[model samples]
Target: MKKLIESLLRQALSALPVSRVPPDARPAEVDVERTRDAAHGDFASNLAMRLAKTTRQNPRALAEALIDALPGHPAVAKTEVAGAGFINFFLKDTAYYDEVARILADSGQYGRSDQGGGRSVLLEFVSANPTGPLHVGHGRHAAYGATLGNLLEAVGYRVTREYYVNDAGRQMEILAVSTWLRYLERCGETLEFPANGYRGDYIATIAGQLHEAVGGELRRAAAEVFSGLPADEPRGGDKDAYIDALIARARALIGTDAFRRVLSVALDDILRDIQQDLGEFGVRFDRWFSERSLEDDGSVDRALAALEKAGHAYRRDGALWFKSSAFGDEKDRVMVRDNGVKTYFASDIAYIFNKLARGFDHLLYVWGADHHGYIARLRAGLVALGGPAGCFEVRLVQFVSLYRGGEKAQMSTRSGEFVTLRDLRREVGNDAARLFYVMRSNDQHLDFDLELATSRSNENPVFYIQYAHARVASVMRQMQGRGLEHDGRQGLARLGLLVEPQEVALMKRLSQYPETVEQAALQRAPHLLVHYLRDLANDFHTNYSAHQLLVDDPALRDARLTLSLAAQTVIRNGLGILGVSAPESM
Candidate 1:
């Protein structure tokens, strides 16, 4: 409906004489908006007032001229010049009646559009490290990213979902050592675990697996493992320094090859678990990028070489540094330490370079809110490597606070005292989990109420929407039981019978689906679609309650059924985008 009005307005503008309205005064794009008040009109535009000053004419007079030049269309009942030269359009009832037929015809493809124009996007999200299992927080990231990808593809964007594996870092080393310590304990060697080590129960389970794989082959005496090492945090020493020294000792005693074997075993086990968890949650990635691959493929060296050739890198105090401050970062960042090891920041830079080298039109990163400070240096790396500044984007997802009953549940990944995504899914079905996770904007803090989500009532938004779809199915069954059959052809021919206030209201809501999807995709907000579905469900319920679908008049009954089916189609399509099911029987 908005597009139709805009097209008519464009025709009117082209018909206007150039002497009265200069080409510069004409808007490049026509903007038509639905009026808030029914008394004004169905839609309104302020084109005349916008062009008045440039055209050297009175606003009201210009509006009259533009209205006169508008071509006649059956959808428009009348056009009026309101106060301040606003052009108001009162649409005919047939405009909305035809939209119902369009909806049923399009079915699953009704709300889709080609707004993105085939642009390519590389969307990276939920790239949690393989140090531990994914908790409730990562679950929110997965749901939001998956739905956002669906919304993007609906609007015609070519999207590639990715999860970057943080496989090369101190965190991985710590996990490896944690597993080894537990392994030694299982081999009759008792030792106090480091305060800074991963104390999760999963670490012990991995150690059991290691014992099953190589029994006592990698085990060492507790004295040899902890001897001469710095005091641990529990003993009033720096935990970071103690953990680093312990890692070095482990490598020395067991050899680097053996140490890497432990790391590889732990890494493979945890990564496999992550893959299974996400797969069950209906989140799949096109690629699982490895940070170590940047080093293995010489991409990091190439990135450093690019930076140096572009005069953005220099050596200072025995360390290679990137001039990040020149590109809007707070300070210069070191690419390589004085000890000849590349820093994580260097891998970050090369990662962005590799993404751009893949010929993506845009790079979108979904990161935690804490990583907000890292955006500048990363963008600096892109620009220093000669990528467009506008091609890079980041969306920060806030933390999630899980609530069971009234008390807020506390979570810590290192201690493994947290709720996993799989745990949440098991308690509440995936439909409810997916819907509840994205019930708010990504940047807004979410308090997921497990009790409310499990309830089977209208208070739950997912239940309300799915019930609306089921009611239509029930209506069809009831009609069949009454020995009647709906004739859609005749109903479409007799759509003029649908003149009730509830019918008009429902049809108006149905016509807004395409626009709602386009706006939601452009803003990258799934909550907008969530809000729209709720309102649509409310509208469907109100109409169903106020009228009867299986009436005596065959034409009216089929017409009502057509409307009901259109609503069902839209509900199914909307829920499909959110990765939630729309069931026929609630």
Candidate 2:
């Protein structure tokens, strides 16, 4: 419908006299938008006002001339100039009737479009380190990224959802050492767990699995493992240095091969756990891009070489530094330290290079709010490596606070006290969790109220939208119970019988689905879709309450039934994109 109005406006512009609308004054693109109020019209365009400055004419006079030159169309019942030369288009009822029929015909494909022009997009998200279970915060990233990928795909973008596994970092080594310490405890050896170690109970679970695999063969005496080790933070020592020393001692005591096996076991187990958690949450990645693979495949060296050749890299104080400050970063970043270890930033740039090499037109990163500072350096690195600056983008998701009843729920991943995504799903179910996670904008903090989400009332947006769908199904079943069969062809043929104010309003809202989806996808905002579904469901519920869907008149009954089915289809499609199910019954 928006496209139709734009086309008509373009025709009107071309029909105008060359003196009134010169070639240079004419707009290359017409901007048609839905009117906020019913009194204004179905759609409105400010083309006349936009051209007024260039043409040196009064906007109202230009609008009148454009309306006079506007070509006639059956779908547009009338066009009127409103405040400040706004051309409002009042669409005919037949137009909305046709839209309802189109909705029925398209079914699941109704709200999608090819607006993206088939551009390739690489979406990297929730690449949480595999050292612990995914807490509630990671759940947001998973849901947001997954739904955003769905939205992008719906709009015809070739999207590749990816998870960058931080498997090559020091965190994994700490996890291995943590597991080994627990293994020694299983062998009746006493040791003080490092403050920096991953102390999650899942670590002990992994330790038990390690024990089952290798028994006490890898165990060393607690004294030997902790001998000559620096005091931990609890004893006024740097926890980082202490953990590194502990890791070295473990390797020396158990041999490098044994240490590697332990690290592999912990990494594989935790990563599998993460994969399962996300899979169950309806979030699946096309690839789990390994950080270790970047180094293994020599991509890091290549990226560094690109930076060096571009004259964006230089050595300073025995460290290889990228001149990120040259590209607007606050300070230069070290890609490799004096100790000859590549920083995580090095792997990050390598990952960006990999994405570019894979031929993605755009690289979208979904990162936690804490990673906001890293975005500048990463983008600077991308530019330094000769990638287009506009091709890289980052979305920061704010923190999520879980609330049970009225009290804020505390969470800590290191201490294993956090609420896992699985736990949230099991308690509130996936439908509610998925909806609640994206109910607010990504940049806004989410206070996930446990009690409100599980409720089966209007207060819960998921249940309300789903109930609207279920109500339509109930109407269909009730019609069948009364020995009245719905003829879709008959319903579509008699759509003119839908004359009630509620019916017209519902149809108008239904027609906005495609536009709503397109706007949501273009803005990269899933919350807009959530709000639209709520509005759509509200319209459906209002019409259902005000009118009789299963009436005695067969034509009117079937017409309303068709409308109900169309509403159900749209509701289902929207929920599906959000990874929430649309139930047929409450």
Candidate 3:
């Protein structure tokens, strides 16, 4: 029905004089919307106002000309000019019912399309450093990224979900040193736990695994091991410096090769922990591109060379820096430090090239809000590496704050005091958790009120949407029990019986699912789908409450059944896009 309305609008636009709307200034699609107020007519558009200046005529006159342009389609009864310059369309009753049959006919595939024409898209998200378990803030990216992937796929874009593990740099180096320090104590050489060491209890779990792997060769008496260790406080302890010192000591005790092996084992343990946690949290990645792989492939060095050749780079303060400010960044960024260690930006530049080289048409990087400043440099890095400027889009998702029992739930990783995604799923269930992430725009901060989310009220949007689906199921059951034969099985040849005003309004909303998917994918906004689904569910409920699907009249029963089936198809399809279930019974 949405498509049909759009077609009708194009027809109207075509009929208008070339003087009013230029041949190319016309809108490609016309929307047959359900007005919030009945007095505004069934559906309205301001294309006339948009055309008035170009046509050099009053908007009201232009709107009238547009209204005169709409012909007698199988669906539109009439279109009127309203307000200053709005085209209000009134769809015929039969046209509304026709869309129901089309929707039911499409079934689960109702909203999907081949609009993307096989273009491949790469979606990278939630690339949190594997130093610890994922916190709530990362959960939003997981949800948004996954759902966006699904949305793009529905429109026919091949999408690969990826997580770039930052396992080749200082953060990982620090992690290794921290684990070794913890392992030393288990080996009986008591030492202070470095303040810079991973404070989460998960670190010890890795250390214990290292001990098991060494067959107690790393074991030590507890008294001697912790002898010089400071009490658990901010301390006179500088964790980073202490861990760096311990790393040096380990290299001495067991040559560089043996110490490197131990570090590898520790890294393996930490990486395993990360993979397990994220998997259980429902973030599935198509690829775990190792940061080391880029270095091995020479992409890092090659990318640096490109920057040098492009003259986008130079040495400053004994560091090789990319003049990112030349390309609109706040300031230049270092690709290599004075000591020759590559910066994270260098690694990312290589990774970006690797992604495009793999043949993805577009690259999307989803990062946490704290890293918002990195977008400009990353884009700059890409340009210096010969990739088109602005080809890469970096979306920063604001953090998530968890509140349980009306108080701020402290998330101090140092104290082992953060709620895991597993904990959130356990408390609120997966559906609620998924919906919570998309409840707001990605750039907007979301205050996820646990109490409100858990409540079984209209305020709980997930349940409300689900209930609409369940209610349709109930209607179907009721119609079946009434011995009413449904025309939805064999597409209804005649739908004129569905003439009620509310019926047409409901069908109009039902027909918008596909266009919503396309628009949401184009804008890279999943919240639009969220809001669209809610509106659709509300429309279904409104029709369900005011009308009966299984009326005594067979003609009416069949028509209504078609409408109900369409609603079911749309609801189910919508839930699928969100990675939520649409139960046949509930």
TM-score, one value per model: 0.97, 0.98, 0.90
The regions of model 1 sitting more than 4 angstroms off are 53-57
Model 1 residue pairs with clashes:
none
**Model 1 clash tally, residue pairs:** 0
Model 1: per-residue Cα lDDT over 1-586, one tens digit each: 8899999999999999999887888889988988988887899999998888777689999999999999999999999999999999999999998999999888999999888999999999999999988999999999999988999999999999999999998899999999999999888898899999999888889999999999999988999889999989889999999999999999999999999999999999999999999999999999999999998999999999999999999999999999999999999999999989889999989999999989999898888899999999999899989999999999888999999898898888777788999899999989999999889999899999999899989999989999999999998988889888989888887888988888888998999999888888888899999999999999999999999888999889888899989999999999999999988786
Candidate 1 versus the native: TM-score?
0.97
> Cα RMSD (Å) per model?
1.6, 1.2, 3.3
**Candidate 3 C-alpha lDDT tens digits along 1-586:** 5566666677878987776578877666555565778677567787777777666679998888777777677677778888888888776666656667778777888889998898888899988777777777777888899889999999999999999988787777667766766776555566656666676777777777787788666544545334444343366656565555555555655567766666677677767866886676566899988998888889899988888988999998999999999887999999899989899899888898788678778888888888888888888777766777655887788888877668777777656678777677778877888888988999888887777778888878898898888887887777678675566543365466666767776777887788899888888888998898898888888887888777777777777777777777898888888877787665
Instruction: Report lDDT per candidate.
Output: 0.92, 0.92, 0.77
lDDT of 3 at 60: 90
Q: In model 1, where is the ten-residue run with the lowest total lDDT?
A: 48-57
Ranking by TM-score: 2, 1, 3
Residues 1-586, candidate 2: write the lDDT tens digits.
8888998999989999897777987879999999999999999999999999898889999999989989999998999999989999999999999999999999999989998999999999999998888889999999999999999999999999999999997888998999999988887898788999988888888999999888889978888888898989999999999999999999889998999899999999989999999999999999999999999999999999989998999998999999999998999999999999999999999999988888999999999999999999999988887789999999999999999989999997777888999899999998899999988999999999999999989999989999999999998988889888999999999999999988998999999999888888888899999999999999999999999888899899889999999999999999999999988787
